[model samples]
Target: MSTAVATRSGARRIRLDVRLLVLALVMAGAVGYLMYTGLQGTAASYFVTVSELQARASEVDGRRVRVGGDVVTGSIVRGGPGEPIHFRIGDGTSELEVVYSGVLPDIFAEGRHVIVEGLYRNGQPVQADSVLTQCPSRFEAAPTASSS
Candidate 1:
């Protein structure tokens, strides 16, 4: 009968609409999850000073962190080919040893401002995954007072 056929057709449409709605919600959730994870991956790690990092050694050990300090002069030791580079980074009053196994930046050197991102191990040394350096001349020279 025409009435019976129309009833079945309406039910089918309703079922299809429900399925589509569920699918849309699932897709949206997947996209949201991907975006959240992607942003997390690209987020910058929290920057910590050498002294702060030292003070929080127990809380931060084995966790990823970013530390900024000047490279300690006379502390860089280059190993044989393919070996890790060892150095010390310090604030004026606190310092930590860093061991890196990657290629050093061209401007990396002693007494330079550097940021190392990695994990702190054994409550002392940082096992650096990346090393960044700031150009010494990037800032303008201080203005001098003219003699009267």
Candidate 2:
């Protein structure tokens, strides 16, 4: 009778341990899945340069992408009311033409480093929906004693 009672108790403890292990595995899997999906949303908007896109046009055409480059000198052309602004962005060795229609950032100008997000089609200028300029290395000039 004593042996039988001890065996039953041992079996019950084993079952409880198994259940706890299974629960922990399920929780870990759920958390990992959530993190993967969150990162996918951001990674989908991949970043590439003009040359990189040109090399893989068929793969990225018509898809939204981000291209970072400097505004090519003398490539900026402002349009009349309601017209799109045209410009060329380059990575020194190569360049791409872009057309953007939106409120340009106050800091946007020729020769500034910018990141353009828009749709890209093979052999055509990007239809940019947004333009972002890099913050200047010096946010403000040091005030002279007279100015202060």
Clashing pairs in 2: none
Task: Estimate TM-scores for all models.
Answer: 0.72, 0.72
Q: How accurate is candidate 2 locally (lDDT)?
A: 0.91
Residue 1 miss distance in model 2 (angstroms): 3.5
Q: Against the unseen true structure, what C-alpha lDDT does each candidate score?
A: 0.92, 0.91
Q: What's the CA error at residue 91 for candidate 2, in Å?
A: 1.4
Best by lDDT, which number? 1
Per-residue lDDT of model 1, residues 1-148, tens digit only = 9999999999999999999999999999999999999888777655789999989888887898899999999999999999999999999999899999999999999999999999887566899999999887757899899999
| Model 2 alpha-carbon drift over 4 Å, by segment | 38-46, 80-82, 139-148
